[model samples]
Target: MTQRLLSFGLGYSARALARRLLAQGWTIHGTTRDAEKAEALAREGVQPLLWGQDDIEPILAQSTHILISAGPDEAGDPVLNAHGALIREHAVRLRWAGYLSTTGVYGDHAGGWVDEETPLAPSTRRGQLRQEAEAAWQAVPGLPLHIFRLAGIYGPGRGPFAKVRRGTARRIIKPGQVFSRIHVEDIAQVLAASIAQPDPGAVYNLCDDDPAPPEEVIAYAAELLGLPVPPAVDFDAAEMTPMARSFYAESKRVRNDRIKRDLGVALVYPDYRAGLDALAQDEAGE
Candidate 1:
């Protein structure tokens, strides 16, 4: 039987996974709010449907696996808010469901380590929203839910190279601050592993082994590009957007043993060094 996946939000990470599945002969149907992107996805071999413009029930019924990457607003999860009842009613062929969440739900751990078993104490509103979204999805009766609390996602076009190239890179130094990040490829791999294993109600932390300071990552990108490393700016003194400032409020090293222990996923890029090296190589090639 051909595997069919319905990606509720065909954004960056979802597109990465969709490309992999498409290569392996799986049929992919993705929903996007943008018309041009829908056309672009269609050209790239994914069947695209517009949000609110197209009926999601037929797609939900046909999907063997469902992945929700759409974020929640103040109103709540757009996918759940719009199609919770329809999903419970029409997901007849669905064997697996995955929710792409964030490790921010763990909030600030004072630069301490947190595993999957750690209780959530979100420090930010965004984190609190994710916590709420996780519960909302888990509450859906008959829905096979797997929540992946992803770390700082960095890969390909979304890496530090762009900021460095634009001369907008800043090394914000915060004492004892460390962050866990994962390559987009690893995120896809972990999701695929979970889909293959099919464990409902499982929660996995998707992150790399090494958790380092944000300044170090920026410096490494500069070294790879042979550019002058951006000067360090103290976090307290740095002029930043409210969103960027909010990100700096949390400091925690996330653990990724569950994905390995449960799904047997071997991460492709285990550290920022390996991930950055690959990105640098790709940049050189381009």
Candidate 2:
């Protein structure tokens, strides 16, 4: 049987996974809100379906796997709100279902470690929504749900090199504030591995082995670009949007042992240095 995947939101991370699956002859149907992005997806060989504008029921029926990257709103997960019933009806046919969640759902661990077994106690509204969304998806009976709690995602055009080159990168300093992050390509491989070995109701934390302070990452990026390290600014004194400030509200080192031990997945970029190196090399090559 031909494998078909229907992705709720074909954003950066999901698109990376779609690229891999598409190369393997998998049919990819992804949803996007923008017409231009729909054209972009089509250019990448993804069948683009506009959310809320296109009928997804038929697509859902034929999908052997589904990936939900759509974020939750105040009410709840948008996908579940609109197609929870449809997904429930077609649950039995789905070979695998993946939900992209965040490590924030584990809440602040005071720079401590949190694994998949950690009890969820989200500190922010965004984290709370993701936790609730995870529960809502797990509530759907017979759904082969797999939850991936991703740490900070960085790769390709999303890295800090741009800011470093533009001379606007700031080394935001908050005492003991450390974060775990994953390369986009690493996320893709983990998802592909999980698909190869389906484990329903499984939860995995997607992050690198190294969890370092935010300032250190900025400094490294500057060094990679051969630019002077950005000036350090105290977190309290720095002027930032509420959304950016909210990120500093939590500090945790998310564990990614499950993805390695369970799926036998090896991350291509194991740490920020390696990831940044590859990104720099890619940029240089381009």
Q: Which candidate number would show the highest lDDT if scored against the true structure?
A: 2
The clash tally of candidate 2 reads 0
Query: What's model 1's overall lDDT?
Result: 0.93
Model 1: runs farther than 4 Å from truth?
Answer: 91-93
What is candidate 1's lDDT per residue for 107-160, written digit by digit as tens? 899899999999999999999999999999988887888999999999988989
- The deviation in Å at residue 63 for candidate 2 is 0.7
Using TM-score as the measure, the top candidate is 2
TM-scores for candidates 1 onward, in order: 0.98, 0.99
Clashing residue pairs found in predicted model 2: none
lDDT of each: 0.93, 0.96
Residue 39 of candidate 1: its Cα lDDT? 90
